[model samples]
Target: MDWSEIIARSEKSFWGLLGLRMLSADSKLVELGLTVNESHLNSMGIVHGGVLSSMMDQAMGTLVTAIKNGSQGVTTHLNVNFLSAMRSGELIASAYPLHETHRTMTLRSEVRGEDGTLACISTATFRLPRDSK
Candidate 1:
């Protein structure tokens, strides 16, 4: 399925923005892009950290979803590193599966600004469903 169809079937808040297009997806990777707006800004006038985190989470989770074998999972942990400020404009986030086991999966993601500068990096762990039938 396409990104729009995936969003329509999932609970993704940021999916409402048309900017978030799926550049690619496969059994091991997922990529999404977004355009920052006023709503994404914080008191400092830069993109909010929460928004960045959410996007990172979504990208990483999508990677996990693609690798899983007809099972769903919940994020168990997320580690993020903010390298630079995300200005209000266009940006891209890409994720890839680091590892996957019978009960867990690990993913890594990076957020890049419109200029292709690294804004943030993240790693997430998810617990797979026990009944993965």
Candidate 2:
């Protein structure tokens, strides 16, 4: 399938609201890119936890959808761990499958900072479509 279609579909979603780009998508993984800006900063001038969480959430969902071959799913649970903080520059989230059953998929994601530091680690569970095989 053409990955552009998947990216275009995200243009109107919350991911777009944060200015994230769907950089790449494979059957079992997905990557998103973002450049930190003032709007994404907290009062301390650091990237807010919410922004990191949202990036993980989007990465998990995008990976699940790609794995399902466009049959998307909803997040059943999300857990995030903040390893560090950042003030600016580019960030990327690389999400890959941790496990998958007939009804759900769990993903492990790493959010990397501009200098390639591990900013956050997230694990998310997604409910497969009702008719998913």
- Top lDDT hit: 2
Question: Model 1, 1-133: lDDT tens per residue?
Answer: 3445676665355556534666677777788888888888899998888888878887887776666643557999999999999877788889988877888888899999989899999999999888743
Off by over 4 Å in 1: 1-4, 11-14, 17-19
- The TM-scores, one per candidate, come to 0.86, 0.94
lDDT of 2 by residue, 5-120 (tens): 76777778887789998778887678999999999999999999999999989988888878887888899899999999988999999999988999999999989987899999
| Per-residue lDDT of 34 in model 1 | 85
For candidate 1, what is the TM-score? 0.86
Error of 1 at 73 (Å): 1.5
The number of the candidate with the highest TM-score is 2
Residue 55 CA displacement from its true place in model 2, Å: 0.5
Residue 42 in candidate 2, Cα distance off native in Å = 0.9
Tell me the whole-model lDDT of each prediction, alpha carbons only: 0.79, 0.89
Alpha-carbon lDDT of model 2: 0.89
